[model samples]
Every structure is written in structure tokens, then in C-alpha cells.
Target chain A: MSILSLTAVELGRKIKAKEVSVSEAVEAVLAQIETYDKEYNCYISVDREGARTRARKVQKLIDSGELTGQLAGVPMAVKDNICTKGLLTTCGSKILESFVPTYSAQAVLNLENAGAVIIGKTNMDEFAMGSTTETSAFGVTKNPWNTQHVPGGSSGGSCAAVAADECFFALGSDTGGSIRQPASFCGVTGLKPTYGTVSRYGLVAYASSLDQIGPVAKDVTDCAAVLEAIASYDPKDSTSIKRDDYDFALALTEDVKGLRIGIPKDYFTDGLDQNVRAAVQSAARLLEENGAFVEEFDLSLVQYAIPAYYVIASAEAGSNLARFDGVKYAYRSKDSKGLHEMYKKTRSEGFGEEVRRRIMLGSFVLSSGYYDAYYLKALRTRKLIKNEFDKAFEKYDVILAPAAPTTAPRLGESLIDPVKMYLSDIYTVAVNLAGLPAMSVPCGVDLKGLPIGVQLIADCFKEKNIIRAGYSIEQAVSREKCEAARAAESKATEARN
Target chain B: MADIITDEMIDYVSILAKLELTPAEKEQAKNDMAKMLDYVDMLNELDTSGTEPMYHVFPVSNVFREDVVVNGDDSEGMLKNAPERKDNFYKVPRTVD
Candidate 1:
């Protein structure tokens, strides 16, 4: 296979064994980006010189035997929201279009320390305020599966880059399904680790309580390996957690024996597309055949997740985004007479329609009369959702559901009606609200040729359960493909005879 | 609650959000906010009477450390991207009338 076609771990192994040099790998990916990125719009910025420079340094370290990790000398992309010292980190917003960080995000720093070469920054929704990348000041990233459709947002560019082989792997942030939903749409693997497992030090905050940095890659193993490399505790971020185990890759044993998987009956109700529902259900059945005990259960309060998620996320987004006041490291209006005018004009001109709406909603909810009615009510409902997940986990090791309600929607289909877009995040948002780890693995392709994702969720810090289940599901899917191909070949031979 | 998203409400919230919206944007905001609030009113269906509000996912309280600086300051790097700067400080519009 071509170097660009190899998974991140496969490429890493090749680089470590001298089968492929780090520079050669970096050059291959840059070449791929040069050819296809304009069509896909998967990147906000591609650091060609930076990637080449880092590749040379990483190759030197590899030769000297100083850096020997699985990801050492591997080239990767970063979502724009995660800071890269000199790269423009716009968070897909015009407010900070020219802003560059003086330091890297803790997760990016961790990967760099492990000898991973930074390629560039990917595109995202403006302040992560929208489900589709259409809200970005920059243009939307097209789904690699079909250019007419969206590569879900706000980590759409990261997932698209991985799917299109523009990067070996990419880092993305999840604050209510940004990573997993896009990963699903792009037919790649993405993991949203339990909140606080990955430090959010330099991540452009959307919702401080919900944001997390995770990996998007070609397969479950690459996702696990990338997660293992970046998951770290940092004193810099007060919410960062010190965990006992960070060996996420070791969970890829492809063993689902006696695994208890719960299929939430609520996820299969109205609004879920029949094809997407069947794809997830069949994946669960495959696991059951592999000795996993799968059962349907009532995961109530599901209907409340969307309303609560939007309220809490918008409220926190409004608070977190208040720092962009046209003073420090952001665009300032030229036609402002006074300080308050400067703030108002800069924000009004800089932010997009979706961002403005969310901020306005946030202000209204947190205003005097509605704080208890909306924001507090959402928070209380959030606690109830977490309690439901906790109750479900007591009887199940992992929860299986569809990553998105349907396959990737055609571009312009979702943006017109914002509430319809929010409803698409139904399956993935509750995982974030409960602060749990979830992985989206491509299970099957729909009749329209778009891929469907099966989400594997585990309770906080129990990443191994979901990772193991995800790996097994991937294995079973690949085996089924092989058997189908073999039968087709035999049928062809019989026809020839 | 039906007509809660009035022009007055949008104007008040826009000021609170520090956004100077045009008349068209204000009208659009009124309609959108009304729809969103109508949808968000669904949360009222659930009676969360005794549940404590979860401000954060974890039970983390005050995270304190010894009062020591870990890294030296690079004022130049920090100010490099400032929209307007003068003598190691961000320059903003005149606040004093």
C-alpha cells in the first residue's frame, strides 16, 4: 500500500524500522495535501516548512535512539482550536483570525515530546458553536466520502484530513460530539476520552467543563495509540486528572468475550434513520455472536439531553468567549469611538450568525429572571443524565449506539434549521454530559455509500472497556468484508465456468 | 412565555452580550431566540426538584499550588498578536469620556 494509505501505527512502525524515513513520510502527506486539500478544504493552515523542519529533527532523534515511541517521527494534524506556538489558531472564527499562541496546548506538547511531527491546523466551527462546519468563517470541509456533503463539525477538518490521507492522524476537541460526530461522518475512528483525562491548558475554550482533546485516525488502534500518547495530567489545567493507567493501546486485544454491552432502546426510537439504526444494531449483534452479552434497556431521560446540552454549552461558551474583547490578541474594530463601542463592534463584526445567536441565548438564560429557569434547570438535568448513565453502567460494561442519527448530511441541508442540526447530536451529547469516554468506529456503508458509525461508550476512566469493544467491532467488520469478498470471488469463478 | 422574545428583550440581551447588532440582526435574533426558548422549555417537563445543579462533571474544588512561578515571562511573545499595542500594554479605545 502507499505510504499515505497506511494507518498511523503502521507508518510509525515503518519509520522506526527504517523502511520509511520520517522526512519521506512527511513529504508524502504534504504532497497528498497539495493535491486534494483544495478540493476537501480539510485544513485551515498547512505548515509545510514547519512539518519539514520537525521531520528532520525527529529523524535525527530517531537515528540517535533518543526517541523510540510508537508515534515517534510520525506526522499529524491538529485542530485549529488547539494552540500551536506560531501557527494561526482561529478556532474557525474571524474574531481571532490572525492570533497565534506563544505556547502549545498541553496535549500537543505531550505528542511533540513523544517525537510526533506537527503538520498544521485543521478547520472547525466558529467557537465550536455549530454542529456543521458551515458556521466557520472559513469554508466548510467537504466529506471525503462525498464532496456534496459535510464532514461533520467542529472537528470536521481533522476527521476529513484523516479520511482523505492528508494526515496520518489528527487531534480534535470534543465538547458535545464535535469529534465523534465528525469522525462518524468521515468514516474514521475518533475517541473522546473522559473529560479531565486530557489536559485542556491551551485549548481555545468552548465550554470549559465539556471540552476535551482526543485523536481522530484511520482505525481504532490508531485512536487508542494516539490517546495513550496525549493523555496526561498537568498542573497547568485545574481540571486535568491524574490517572493510574494511560496504556490505552494495550486494550486493543479484539476480545469481546463475556463483555456486557447495553443497547439503549431510546436511541432506536423515532428520528433515527432506518439504515443507520440497522448498521448499529447489526454491529451489536456481531459482538453478541463473539460472546458479548448484548441487551436492550431503557435509558430514559434521553429526550432531555439535547435541551440541557445546548443550554449548558451555550451558557459556558458565552462566559468562556468573553475574553475576546478587541484588546489582546484579537481583531479590533477600526470605527469605534469608545471602549464599549470597540467591544461591541468588534464582537458583532467578528462573530458569525450561529455564534451570535448562541451568545445571545446565553445572555438571556443567565439574565436575572431566567437563570434559575434555564441555566440552573439544565445543570440539574445534566446531573440527572449522568445519574442515568451511572445506573446503566452498573449493569453494563459498555453502551452501544449510533454516533449520528443518519449518515453525513448534504452540505446546506442542516444549516438552514439550527434545531434540526442540534437534534442530530442526540446519541453523542449525553456521553459528554456524563463525562464518559466514547469511540466512534465505522461499521458499514449506507446504500448512498456514506459510512455509518457505531459508538462505544464507557464510564469515566474506563476507556479500556470501550476501546476493547471498538477493536472487536472493527475486527468483526473487517472479517465480514473478507468473507463477503471471498464468496463474491467464488461466485465469479462459477459464472466463468 | 409565548411572546417572551420581544424587541426589548433582544436589545437587553444584546447589550448584556456586548454585541452591537443591526436592526435586521436584532429582528432575526428575536425570532431565533423565541424558537430556541420554546424548544428549551421542554426541560420543564422533568421535575428536578431535589437534584443539585452540576456546575462541573468532576467534584474538583479549589486547585491550589505553592506560590511559585514555573516559567519566565516573555512579554514580547505575549504581545506579538495584540491588535494595538504600546509600551508593553494592550492599547484599547478611550474609556474616559
Candidate 2:
């Protein structure tokens, strides 16, 4: 039964051995979705028949001993922002509620080519603007651990699907901590690949420079497997990094024997929640015990990351989202008389408040007289932040920090002040601004029994180092006692039942 | 930074972006836009002398490719997605009407 609890690699081995047929495993996932999705709000839609059909094809291939694809029969889900052919790629917004993509995203194409079965598109922050997926025009996705708390966002749904066993792995887009923050809250491993590492062809543009499609899975190896499947250049997206240039997954081994991890002195400041701090410190100690050096490095430039990230991401978001005018592919205002009215009514009524807020902020910063004052300056400051990271990597193999300042907060706690919600992505956003690769792995749990994640940020195109360090922690934490601690509270419930 | 970005400025941006905003919403935007801009202006205090501005983190050159007929000619797929399409093109409102 631990095959249900195994890594994607282990599961793939079982499938290849025909010990577990693809259809049986997929049906079990579907059954789990049916049983638990109501509690977590993890899925926007579940393609039961389509998943069964896909699973049957995979099963047939396995029966013929023709399992050539690396991820044959693996079940994966995608964030709704990805353009899966014929699927409603709504980006969790009302505007494109009826719009479906005619073409698949290159990343999705790669996954399908490798025989990964996509079950459905997961929910997200509308247009990937907000930190909490509560910004979705559709309902908010609840944290699988505690329904009352948020799973973090905007990749909350993807992270939850994997954490709650709705799917083995899910593809999520990280514009600004969308993937890692949610993964942290949901007790999963999520990777934000270096900016160009993953193709952004059909990501429904949200701050294009910051956006990247990454993997969320139960652990680091699955994250690496999903990353390997999706990471490649496409002619369609100019920003896509060619795999020939950087074979990031090729360097995955337990070789962090002498690798140094920088713990930014600024990160462990006065206000970091004591439990989250303790959890990360404990993880650092564990890594130290495992024969790696953890030393404090000063990234003074990171203090400005939040402000710089907002200026740059919002400005780019304003430009990218401008294409969503009613005249184009999405939902148009029906009753409008002219072009102007149509554009106004369509976007005004169509966009969620968070989307509108970003667009408005984006517009304001890039507007006349303020262009040189805001947008241009932020671009310059972004370089400084990247320089800090680039310089730090010269000294340290990877940078270690808390995935989030704290564990998942109660759903409505920070939703009121939109500014405060943006602050939640503080630690993870700078990695986006710098376009670095980072992974969040479940290192430890707090006193409250909530899972805590430690972030390992590697240099650009050096995802192997990320997984190298992350996997060490993953293996150390995979022991019987460590694993038991995760399920102990649940075992108590079983005792009561 | 002004306490208010004028309706005229919003109109200017809308024109540049090919988007449109309403008068009442424009008034609301004028207020909201000001707060957002002021937040951005907070960065003006930082000193960035001798910094090389970079748009992308990866040092990729302009990825110009030879323009060829790599058309997405999946007509049935395209037409199937359109709310209203006729004869392979998207159906639109008449310009004069």
C-alpha cells in the first residue's frame, strides 16, 4: 500500500513491472479525488473519463512491453494557466470562463509525449497575480492539511492536489512564489526552475519575466522527474532555455559532501515566526549533521526584492494582460455598443478585484512621466538583486532559507489587506526577480503539527544543485520515525474511529 | 508623484494598450492608480549608480528565427474553439455597423 506513498520513480517502476496496472492506480486517484476534493477544493475540474481513457492507453503500452517514454503511465495535473488543448484554460478567472485553448503548451506537449496522463487543470490566482489563490473568480482552494487554512498561492490547487493524493504530481507556474509558497503550505516539494529552464509558451502571460512552469510533487525526486520532463526550449517561446545548453537534471546525485549553503543573515531577522525559524534551524542542523556547511551570507540587496518584484511584475502584468481586451480570444461583453464599451465592460466585469488591482498598479507605474521614475528604476534594481545572488553562488553552492515566513495561515486572515497578501511572498519572490531556481521540501513540522518547508535556491540553470541539497534533506527526513511524525496526528484520528 | 493620476493619463494608457476604461471607473482608477504609483516611487530613494540594467536573468540574445510556414493550421481545432467563426476566420462585428 506504500506504493500509494512511493515517489513517482518507485511508482513508475511498479507500473513497468505490471505489478500495478495503470488503470487501477488512476482509478484509485480518481476515487481519492471524489472522496477528498470537496474537503480541499483542490481541483477545478476532474476529467474522470478522459483520465480513464488515457490510463487504458498507457496500460496497453505497458502490456506490449513498449514502455519507452520515461514517465509512461504517470498521472500529472496542470495549473489552469497552461493551455491544454480543448481544456478550459480559464486561469481561474471569470473573463475566460468559456475560452479553451486550441493548442497545447509546449510543456504539456513534452509531458504527454513522455506518456504522462494529465487528469485536469488545477485552480490558481486569477491571472496569477495574488499570493493567495483566494483571488480566483472561482472558489478559493483550501489547504489539504487544514481546510480552514490556505494552501498558499497562486499554485495552491496544484500543491494541494499532490499533497492530498489527488494526483502524483502537478505542474504549476511561479510568477512570484506561486509554486514554492503553496508547496510549503501543502507539505510538498515544488521547484521553480531558472527563468528560461521551462518553456512559457502557453502560460497565459502573468508578469512574463517572472513566470515559469515548475513541478509540485510529494518529494524532491518527483519534482526533479517532472522538471526533467518539462524543461526544454521551444521555438514558440523566445525565453525557453534549450536543454542542450543546460542539462540540469543530469547532475542529480547525493554529492553535497562539501557544498556550502548560504543562510542569509537578513532572512533570520526579528519578525520571522519563531516556529518556522525553529523548523528551518532544525533543518540546517540536520544538513550540518549530514556533512554540509551552513554559514550566514549577507544578501543586503534581497531586502529590496519585494518592492522591486512588485514594480517589475506588476508593470509586466499590466502589459501582458492588456491583450485580454474583449476584441480578442476571451469573453467579450455582449451588450456593448462599440469597441471602447466592449473593452471596458469586458475587462471591468470580467476581471477579479486582485487582477484589476495589479493591472491598475501595472498601468500606473508604466504610465507617462512615471516610466523613468518607476519601471526603469525597478529593472535596474532587479539587476542588483540578481548580482547579489550571482555573487553569493560563487561562494556557496546553494542558498538556504524558509519557503515562507510561517506555515499556512487561516483563510481570511490576510485576504483583507491586498498589500499584506503580497508581503506573504517576500522570501520566494526575489528568486523570481533574479530568475534563479529554488525548491521547497518538507524539512520538518512545527509544534502546531503544521508542515514547514525549507527553500534551497540554486544559481541560474543549476537545478541539479537544488535537487542535490534538497534530496539529501529528503532522504534524511524519509526515515521511519520522521515519516511517522507526519502521520501521527492522523493515526490518532484512526484510533478514535 | 501626484496624489492623483488624471483621467487624461488613464485615457492615454488605454489608447496605447488598445484597452478602454469608463468615466466612473476612470475616476475610481485615478484614486487607485495614485496609491499604486506612490508605492512604486518609494524605490527612488535607493542608489543604483554604475549598475548595468538587465531585463532577463539569462543572457540570451534576441532569438530571431527564419520566418517560415510553421502555421498552426489546425482549422477544425481553431474553429472548434471560436465562439463564432465563419470559413476559417473569426467572425467579428462589422466596423461601420
Candidate 3:
């Protein structure tokens, strides 16, 4: 098998054992990207030279008997929103198209310190404002499973890259289901670490409270490994939680015995496709059969999740994005009459339609007369959602839900109606609102052969619980596939006999 | 739901957001914002009288740090990305009349 197709864990082990060289693995990934990325549109920038230099340095370290870090020699991709020193970190917007940060984000530094070579920066929705990557100024990323469908957004490129084996794993920032939705659509394992558990020092803020940088990879194990590398506290991000180092990789035991998995009834309600609902329900059953207790529960506050998320996210986005106004380090309008005109023209020209729409809504909601009516009310509703999750966690260790309402939609199907696109994130946004860790793992495929993902959510700092539960679900799914293959093999033998 | 967003409201919001919208774009924004507001009006159905607002997920307040310089001054590196720069300062249009 090609080295590019191996999981991050397997590749790391092989590279360390000298059975595979880091250069060869990097070359394989580069070759794959060269051949496939043009069609997939998964990457915005590929740092081929930088990756080669890092891989060669890692090989030298391995030969000299001084190799260290869990992910040594593993090639990875980062979402374009995360700042990389001297690399083009355009958050998939024309405003910052030429903007390159002199300093790297904390997560990037952490990944590099762990010896993971970042091969490229992936495309994303403009400032992470949309559900489908169609809003990206660069271009929409296609699902690797089928070229006609979209890899869900705003971290669509990260998920697509991992799904296409352009890289072993990729880093994606989650604000209102950006990471998990795409992972679900692309048939990969994506984890959104509990808010504040991962540092957001250089992650361009979409919504400060909801934004988190997490991992997308081939499976739950690789997701856990990448999460371990990037999860840390940095003083630069004031919201970053100061905690002892966690070994997420050590928590990936396929033992869900006695674990309580709560299936929220609202998630299975109308608007969810039958295929997606069936796949998630089967995931719950798999966990139950593995000795875990599965029960239906009521999270009554779910209906308000979408409204509150949009209100708060747009408001925060307006305030955070107010920094770009033809000044400092972004695009500027050459035909400006004056200072005010320049600011208006620069932003109007630089931002995409969805981005401008969100900014307008944000500004409107935060305006003097509307603050109490919209923004404040949304915050209060956010508290109610958190209270509901807190109540649910008392009886359940983790909640099971469909990651998205359906499998990957056709490329332009969701973009026509904005509200319809917002509804796509119904099941996953509540976890971010509650500041909990959640993951999307591939469980089954739809009738169209597109992958379906099931979400597992845990209370704050309880990522280990979900990881353990997710590991069990992944094993059971694979076991079912194996059993089907065996049955087919025996049937064929009998037919021949 | 009331028609909370009008053309005037869109223009006012555009100015506040520092965005220059064309006449057609203004109409589109008005309609889009109206639909979004209609959707968010779902919050009006909830009774949150006693619930406190949660601006942040974490219950963190007043996170202070030592008043020491961690990153040394790198004016050259910071200015490298400036669209227009002059001697470590960003160049912009004159503000005073």
C-alpha cells in the first residue's frame, strides 16, 4: 500500500521503525496532492519545500537515535484560518489574500513541536461563515467520496484533504459545527475539543466563545493523537484553560461497558433524513450491544440552538472582523474618496456576500435599539441551552446524535436558501453552545453510497469518555463490515460448490 | 413577525458596519436580514425572565497577567505585511481638514 494512504499512527510507527523513511512518506503525500488536489480543491497552499526540509530533519534525528514526539515524521494539513509563520493564512477571503503572519498560532507551534510536518493550508468558507464551502472565495471543496457533492464547510477543505489522503490528518477550527459537519460529510473522524481546552491564540476569531481548533483524521485513533498534540493552554489566549497535559491517545480503549449514551429525541425528529437517522440509531445500538447503556432523553432547549447560535456568532463576528478596514495588513481600495469612504469601499469589495450579510446582521443585532431584543435575548437562550445540557449530563455520560441532518448534499443544493443551510447544523451546534467536546465518526453509508456520521458529545473536559465510546462504535462498525465480507465469501464458495 | 428590516435600516447598518452597498445589494440585504430576523424571532417564544445572559461559555472574569514583555519588539517583521508603510508607521489618508 502507498504510504500516503496509511493512518497517522501507522505511518508514525513505520517511519520510526525505519521501514519507511519520512521523505518517502512526504513524497507520497505530495504526489497524491499533485495528482488529486486540482480536482478536489482541498488545499489553498501546499508548502512542499517546507515539508521536505522538515521531513529530512526528522529523518536525520531518527538516524542519530534522538527521535521524539508521538507524531514524528507525520505529514499534516492545517485549516487556512490558523496562522502559520511566513505562510499565507488567508481565512479563505479576499480581504487577507496576501496576508502572512510573522508569528505562528499556538496550535501550529504545538504540532511542529510534536514533529508533525504541515504540508499545506486547506481552503475554508470565507471567515467560516457558511455551512458549505461554496462560499469560499478560493472555490468549493468537493467530497472525495463523490465529486458531485460538497464536503461540508467551513472546514470543508480540512475534511476533504484527510478523506482524499492528501494528508494523514488536518487541523480544523470549529465554530458552530465547522469541524464535525465537514468530517461527517467527508467520512472522516473529526473532534471539536471542549471550548477553552485548546488554545485559540492565532485562530482568527469567528465567535470567541464558540471557536475551537481541533483535529480531523482517518479514524477516531488518529483524531485522538492529533488532538493530544494540539491541546494545550497558552497565556496568549485569555480564554485558554490551564490544565495538566492529557494523554488522549491512551484513552482510546474499545471498552464502552457501563457507559451511558443518551440519544436526544429532538435530533431524530423531522428534517433529519431517514438514512442519517437510521445510521445514527444503529451506532447507538452498537454501543448498547457492547455493554453500554443507551437511553432516549429530552433536551428541550435544542429548538432554540440555531437561533441563539446565529445571533451570537454573527454579533461576535461583526465585532471581531471590524479590524479589517483598509488599514494595517489587509486589502485596501485604490479608488477611495476619503477615510470613511475608503473604509466602506475596502470592506464592501473585500468581503464575500455571506460574510457581508453576517456582518450586517451582527451590526444590526448589536445596535443600540436592537441589542436587548436580539443579542441579549440570544445570550439568555444560550444559558438555557447550557442548563439543559448540564441537566442531561447528570444522567448520561455522552449524547448521541446525527452529525448533520443528511449526508453530503449536492454542490449547489444548500446554498440557495440561507435558513435551510443554517438548519443543516441543527444537531451539532448545541454542543458548541454548551462548551462541550463532541466528535463526528463515520458509522454507515447512505443509499446513495455517501458516508453517514454519528456524533458523540460529552460534558466539559470529558473528551476521554466520548473518545472511548467512539472507539467502541468504530470497532463495532468495522466488525459488522467484516462479518458481511465473510458471509459474502462463504456464499460465493457455496455457489461455486 | 413584523418587517423589522427596511431599506433605511439596511443603509444605517451598512454605515455602522462600514460597508458600501449598492442599491440592489441594499434591497437584497434588507430582505435577507428580514428573513434572518424572522427566524431569530423564535427566541421571543421563550420565557427567559429569570435566566442570566451567558456572554461566554466559561465562567471566567478578569483574567490578568504579569505586566512583563514576553515578545520583544519586532517592528520590521510586523510592518512587512502593511499595504502602505512609512518608517514603522502605517500610512493612511489625512484625517484633519
Candidates in order, TM-scores: namely 0.99, 0.93, 0.98
Give the alpha carbon lDDT tens digit for every residue of B19-66 in model 2: 556677667666666765665566777797777667888777888989
Name the candidate, 1 or 2, with the larger DockQ value.
1
Residue pairs with backbone overlap in model 3: none
Interface RMSD of 3: 0.9
- In candidate 2 the C-alpha lDDT for residue B43 amounts to 72
Best candidate per TM-score, number?
1
lDDT of model 3, residue B35: 91
Off by over 4 Å in 3: none
lDDT over C-alpha atoms for residue A55 of model 3 = 94
lDDT by residue (tens digit), candidate 2, A117-236: 888889888988777688888899998888888988999899999988888899999988999999998899999998888889988998888899999998877787788888887888
Instruction: DockQ for candidate 2, please give it.
Output: 0.47
**Docking quality tier of candidate 2?**
acceptable
The residue-by-residue lDDT of candidate 1 on B1-97, one tens digit each, is 6388888888899999999998988888988998888899999999999999998889989999999988879689879889999999988888997
- Sorted by lDDT, highest first, which candidate order results? 1, 3, 2
For residue A241, model 1's alpha carbon misses the true position, in angstroms, by: 0.9
Clashing pairs in model 1, backbone N/Cα/C closer than 3 A:
none
Least accurate 10 contiguous residues by lDDT in model 2 chain A: A242-251
Which regions of candidate 1 are displaced past 4 Å?
none
Error of 2 at A64 (Å): 2.4
